[model samples]
Target: MAISYSGYLNLPHGFRSHDILAFHDRDSEQTAERVNYSKNLLEKGILWQGMPACLILQFKKKQQVAITLLAEGGKDVSELEILPIVQRMLGLNQDIDDFEKAHYRHPQLGTLVKKQAGLRVPLSSTPFEALAWAITGQQISLAAAISIRRKLIKALGITHSCGLYCHPNAEVITQLGQDKLHQVGYSKTKAKTLFNLSRGVIENTLPLDDWLTQQTPVEEISKKLIEVPGIGPWTISYGLLRGYSWLNGSLHGDAGVRRGLQKLLGLESKVTAEEAEKWLAPFTPWRALVAAHLWMSL
Candidate 1:
């Protein structure tokens, strides 16, 4: 039997529900997240606190949203547990007022912010998910990364009762050997890194979930993550931005970010990573948010 719980959540100011819902539009396969545009709904499969389930979010009138949790085999989840996960995934508490006020009048970012206001850094369902995605995206183009991610999900993701695949958890990934991962589109080095990460999680050495619970400083967490092989600054920055909402992770190494900066500055030549980092230095403490704005500008 299936079980469900329903509740209404108040939308935060600057919550661009439509834009957030549209995030899954480009997914070549429905592995985890799905959106029903005409119904203003998004369905995502998640493994929360050892329970695999599906969450359905319905955008409604009056700036409030309704959420339903569907769990197979009658597993139950309380409102307290469900609400926080929903809040985090939706980025409800990620306030950008200070960022907007500080940069609303800047020479370059100001216009982008005005045009793309309320853009919060949306997170993966869990820190592990973010880490895996970052590893998958290393040194790859966006289209290629997405294709590889789809393959990984299809190969290892858990299938929910609704037929939607939940992104593979660390334990699940560990079940596959490097050969299998390679066949699923992961490069040999990336496959090795994935094993290291999964083993770290299983051995409790990484303690990602603990860091989130304790609200550990981003620097502290980054230091630990950087020690892992194949985990570089770009991966750490992107993962921290998406997983922990650490807004200052310099994304200057990202091709899209650099391209966005080039376009924003009206530069005729491609911007070097060093140059991009220097240019983005002024937007300290919210560099990731600024990067998001730049991406939206593209």
Candidate 2:
């Protein structure tokens, strides 16, 4: 049996739902089962509290301003749970006034922000899901990583009649061995990391779910995440920005980000991680948005 609900949500100022959905268009890291942006609607499937869920969203405006979300054909989710999950997945709950204020002073970031206002950090459905994506994308191009993850989801995720899928939970991933994972496009080292992360979370060794409500520092969480095999600084920083909305961090080692920075800063040579850090310093607390906009500038 499936449970569902539909309701209006308050959207943040300048929020363009399609532009946010476009972020999902390029990445295959299985951020959602299916994410489609059209002229009138945004449709997606996500695992909500470990259950497969599909949502059809539309913005409504008049005397009352709101966005509509219709949750359909999923198990074990209440209406209350759906909205918050959607909010987190789409970054509807984030207030970017501070980010805008902080970035307004930076010469390049100010123009970037103006060109791409209300572009949220585009969070994953949960911290665990976010970490899974980071693990899959290590040492590869974003498109290739996403392709491998898509294969993983096709092999293990739940599906709908319309052919959309829902990403599996850690419990499900833990059951698959290295052979199965490798068949689904994971390299040996990446496969090991996936198994370790899934089993660690399942056995309470990772305790990623604890960060959902518990007030934990981002660096503390990163420290724990990188302790897992094959995890590294780039994953830690990217996960902080995408999974937990920790915006103060920079995308120091990302090749694409470095290229974007070098071009935006008018540099002839490549921007090293150290140089990226120095350039990112003035942006300070707004690096998250800067990175997001920088990627767009590319």
User: What lDDT does candidate 2 reach at residue 196?
Assistant: 89
Model 1 regions lying over 4 Å from their true place = none
Q: Roughly what TM-score does model 1 have, to 2 decimal places?
A: 0.96
Backbone clash pairs in model 2 (N, Cα, C under 3 Å; residues 3+ apart or in different chains), count: 1
- Over the stretch 173-283, how does candidate 1's per-residue lDDT look in tens digits? 888877888998989999999889988999998988889889999889889898899999999999888788888989999998999999999999999999999988988
lDDT of 1: 0.84
- Model 1, total clashes: 0
Candidate 2 TM-score over all chains jointly: 0.88
Instruction: State the weakest 10-residue window (summed lDDT) of model 2.
Output: 62-71
Best by lDDT: 1
- Model 2 global lDDT (CA atoms, 0 to 1): 0.72
Model 2, 1-298: lDDT tens digits are: 2435656777765676666566666654434534444444555666555556666566544311233333344444455766766677677656577787766666776777777777787787677778888888887888788888888887885764344676677888888777899899999998898898888889987787677667588867878888888988878888777777777777877887788888888889999989888887777776766777788778
Off by over 4 Å in 2: 1-3, 27-36, 61-79
Top candidate by TM-score: 1
